[model samples]
Target: MVLSDLGRRINAAVSDLSRAPNLDEKAFDSMIKEICAALLSADVNVKLVGNLRKSIREQVKFKDLPPNTNNNTKRRLIQQAVFDHLTHLVDPHAEPYKPKKGKSNVIMFVGLQGAGKTTTCTKLARYYQTRGFKACLVCADTFRAGAYDQLKQNATKAKIPYYGSLTETDPAVVAAAGVARFRKEKFEIIIVDTSGRHQQEADLFAEMVQVQTAIKPDQTIMVLDGTIGQAVESQSTAFKQTADFGAIIITKTDGGAAGGGAISAVAATHTPIIFLGTGEHMMDLERFEPKAFISRLLGYGDMSGLIDHIQSITRDSAAMKETQKHLAEGIFTLRDMKEQITNIMKMGPLSKVAGMIPGLGGMMGGMSDADGTEKLKRMIYIYDSMTAKELESDGKILVEQPTRMTRIAHGSGTSVREVEELLTQHKVMAGIAKNMGQNKQNMQRAQKMMQGPNSKQQAAAMQKRLQSMGGAGRGMPGMGGDLSQMMQMMGQGGGGMPNMAQMQQMMSQMGGGGLGGLGNMFGGGGGGGRGRGR
Candidate 1:
């Protein structure tokens, strides 16, 4: 079973138990049985699955629950147990070494051949570089022909500085030379890519040791292929004994059916998984957080991950600042919407971003990245075709002047209906902005309360509010109702911004109409006229 299939099976089991008319111990056991079966099919270790099953049974204690307990309370306990146990299955409880800003941090990569160590080196370098670190890569894989060239190519494409020597035959010598040169130049993060073997060969271990000795690296990471499944446990254990790597990065997770097995196997050895290479793109590396990973796997979404991605890609552009100012003032213009759409494009694949939203991921259904991108392009085109005055307005002017809509549609090569759809989407977001603006005083008070002596109480109250709003199956199809509720919550000083549930609902609305209107315009079927551009 693939990761998505495994998640679906497990989620279905839980949902089935939640909806069971009896909600008895028998139903709980049945759910556990189904989850274990799903995990086993995904190549997770039998011993690990058994332990999980036992842990869940112990945690829930369904038989001991008070007879007076409501079904909702029982469901929450069971769900929490499954979530916590799954998180524990992947968490090593060991913190990986973090590089200091001013100091040189040498990170060495080691793994079996074809585990994607070379490409991952560039991805890691780019990750640190984007975070204000002067990061570089050094190729020390003398065993593999063209290893240096591959690293050179990847580095060049990512625009990261790299060091490699075709003339050097000694891996350790090349590694030491690269580290010395970068350290002298004050590079903050120096990542060394080492050679891998077909198996855990003696020669490979010896070479890894030599490179480790030469660089005295602050951290050594073992890159594992997620497709290898249960075999990763033995492979990782052998490498741990020989190379003593401090962290692990599982690559090829995006398509691996045994990704769950790989993660659980690595965790069994007590090494932290620093990242998961989700795709071939340099930007596909995801920071590993156990809770977030399991949440996303179970289709619960990862709000923190979404926030981090937003923060990572968000720039201090004048346009963005102006939009933020407008949002604060309860004003959202077409220009503001354009800036946001552009940012969404930068956030990465629509599928990935949609997955981060609690309910929107599944709602995306069959929309491909190409389709989503094309739709967004059309929206941008519509904006571009507009006059400067129209762009700056709150979309009311275009609504009042129906001819302006027809003109924009013709100029952008889209139908007038698409233009109207864009305006409708703008209206939704504008209403959100207006509500936010009206609750500016409440937001200020809430911020002050968070900083005050009773901050903990205020924070708890706010969390309670979010939890109440985040009930399962609450938003989807009828996003406007949810958006209104979210705005009302904000107005009541429940943390001025939308919570994860609200954001999911808002995204659903956007996906359904604003961002999602592509289906209608392109004849995929949402009841809007087809575009001329099509």
Candidate 2:
């Protein structure tokens, strides 16, 4: 079974417990059996599975509990026991290697051929670059033809500097030279890509040892193939003998039946799983957390990760401050709208963002990055047609003079109706800006409210306030239509969808309160919070 299948089965078992009118010995045993079956099917070790079952039984054993403990408490303990046991299945509880900020932290990549080691080297550099590190890539894989070319192409595209030799045939020499060059250049993080073989050839292990001795890398990461199933254990063990692996990255985890096996292999080695390769893109690598990973696997969205995504895009305090100044000035310029959309796009695919919401995924569901990117392009094209004065004035020409809208549509090669629609969107946001600028205090208060314990409820109330302030996104094209469709979907599926929390949390991250009206689009986020909807 794949990671997703494991989640599905476990979720079904939990649902069975939640629905049962009575909690009995048979019911508890049935849940345990289901858990064991899921674990075994995922290629987890039979011994580990037996231990998990035994641990759960011991955890819920009633004879050790106080007589006053109720059945509900007993049931909750059983669920907690299962969660705790599952968490330990793959988490080695070892600290991952961390790169020092000011120092040159060298990372060496080692894995079997075709395990995606080269790709991961570039991805790792990009990850560090996004977080403000001066990261560079070095290609030491002389065994793999075109390794330098591949690294060069990725480095050039990311605008990150790189070092490699087209003529170098010795992996150790290449690695040593690259590390020396990057360290002299004052690069903060230097990543070295080493050679690999189809099989664990003696030469392969010897080459790794030679490279390891030469560079003495701060950390050596093993890029494991998640599709290899239970065999990952043996591969990880073999690599462990070659060198000290500080961490492991499981690649091709987007969907692979043996991903569980690959994960469980963490128990076989000293290294912890640090990242998971979810897609082909460099941005697809996610920092792995056992609890959060298990949560998403069970179809529960990852909110903390979503918040981190927003923070990554909005980390520039100065940019957010400028936006706040514009919002406070109550000028919802066309350029401001473009910047908001641009920031959102930079956070990644809209479909993925929608998934962060519990049920709103259906509304913006199945929207690929291509589709979202195209929509962004069209909107920007319209902005490109607008004059500097027009953009700054928030499309006043389109609002006051109908002919200006016509001219823009002809210039943009879009329908006059489309231009009008875009202008209408600006107006909706502008109204929110006006309200927020007028009542910025309440919005700021709401921003702090987010850190409170009942953030979900506070966010919901904030949404209602935004709706009341600006007619709740009524005028935008399909605004009302989408809301009705969403309401219908929620009705069809029992109404506990948690859409409000998802919508509000995201909108609040967008810039707080003035954009709360736009949160109407997602049905949350307007909770008296304000973002830099300048």
Candidate 3:
């Protein structure tokens, strides 16, 4: 039920305006009220929301109407205007790999502890290698224990050359050696994996400046944890002010609600995110596409980049293509759902996946915050409790049995109510999938809007939206357009796994029918309280 908070705001505004037959003064005023409320609740900056409201008012009042204009036209125009305002906030310059030809690249990874800097380096190297560049890894983190060993291990896996000095205490020397070796080896790209920071590490940044000078790198990338929402902007600024960052890599995307904040950070730093590390694997990387990303935030469709990553690793085009066909056709079953979840687990955590989408988070606004994340952990526990047959079979048992529901509730430390909620959500999603099959245009338009320049700007607007919402945005993909389309797709088990909606459904039904009720009974309601659903 995670929808983009921003998208929901826009939709709410439209819905309010649509309630009236014409753009009367009162209707316009009411619409503005809804817009202001939704934006503010989304954590958007108050001043920004105010300015947008003013523009909306002007468009409705002062602007000239076209010949034969009606309330519908007015409403649509207002929708577009609001969308434009939101879009303007996304920072498009954050996309990194749209490189200039013949420009040697120097990218560096920086983030807090446990942010997966070492793994990011290998993924970045693999990214460059795929682009036909000879890449080198610089283990400049001579201080952090096991930092050097970790980078080297991933480098070996990628089969890319690397340089690090075990004896030298000076990281500068190690950086210099790595650079010199890179040049000698004719490497077109060099990635420096610095030690993880303890927030605003001035000395470390100074050292990074020196390393950048030694290499004169064309691009400097700040690696960020997907789970570090509000902290991402400040941390990125610290690095940018020191080393002048060129792009970003939002890593550990399979982790938490950090994806929303990470996207918001892109606008704050005025730099494009070049890549996203969906998993720890070398191939779990993708070029940052604002539209695709925004569409995901809104719960529009399966991520093409995610699919591409899977295809690269699986090398089973036929299976993938067939799966997609089945998904689009709404032919999914519990068996398909199990396979989908297994693959997604292999890729990374569910929360990270949820934040990448657009409107779904808004719907899920009630569940997430800057400091806490329990969505993914809950999902893992629920799924762990399922037997293979249970995962593959639908309506076999516990679909309506209170005793079974109680058992599941106890087993998962969740509630029977929560288990039922999950089932209800799944039913809703299956309906969306069926609807998506019928309304191809809305889905396509949503997809296009998400991948285009609008998405980049909307992401920027999201940062501004953050202050309004109070909690950072979190949710699943594709929530606004046609719920039934999403539901049908879920039934077919799209790209990553059974859609989050289906997962919720299956988990709920299973829990309610068996020991799954334990989760809700103990934890009070499982994760069913994710958001305030309409």
TM-score list, all predictions = 0.86, 0.71, 0.54
Off-target runs (Cα >4 Å) in candidate 2 are 62-79, 311-338, 346-351, 355-534
**How should the candidates be ordered by TM-score, best one leading?**
1, 2, 3
| Candidate 1 local lDDT, residue 418 | 82
Cα RMSD for candidates in order: 5.5, 9.1, 12.7
Off by over 4 Å in 3: 1-68, 92-104, 112-114, 130-134, 157-160, 198-200, 226-231, 252-264, 277-286, 302-534
Better model by lDDT: candidate 1 vs candidate 2? 1
The true-versus-predicted C-alpha distance at residue 109 of model 2, in Å, is 0.5
Each model's number of backbone clashes? Answer: 0, 14, 104
- Model number with the top lDDT: 1
On residues 1-534, what C-alpha lDDT tens digit does candidate 3 reach at each position? 212455555565666676776676677777778766765554444565677788767766634676577776676566555545544545454446543335446666666778787888888788767666778799989878888888888899889888898899787777877877776766778788777665556777677777777766666778877765556667777777777777887777654342455655666678887777776568778776554454343344334555555555445435445545655765433334434444544554433443442222333444433212344344444545555665544423558555765665566666566656555444444444444454444445444544566754643454344324431222122333233334344332122222334434434443422212322222334543333211
Per residue, candidate 1 scores C-alpha lDDT tens digits across 22-44 of 88888988999999999999888
Q: Ranking by lDDT, best first?
A: 1, 2, 3
**How many backbone collisions does model 2 have?**
14
> Whole-model lDDT for model 3 versus the true structure?
0.58
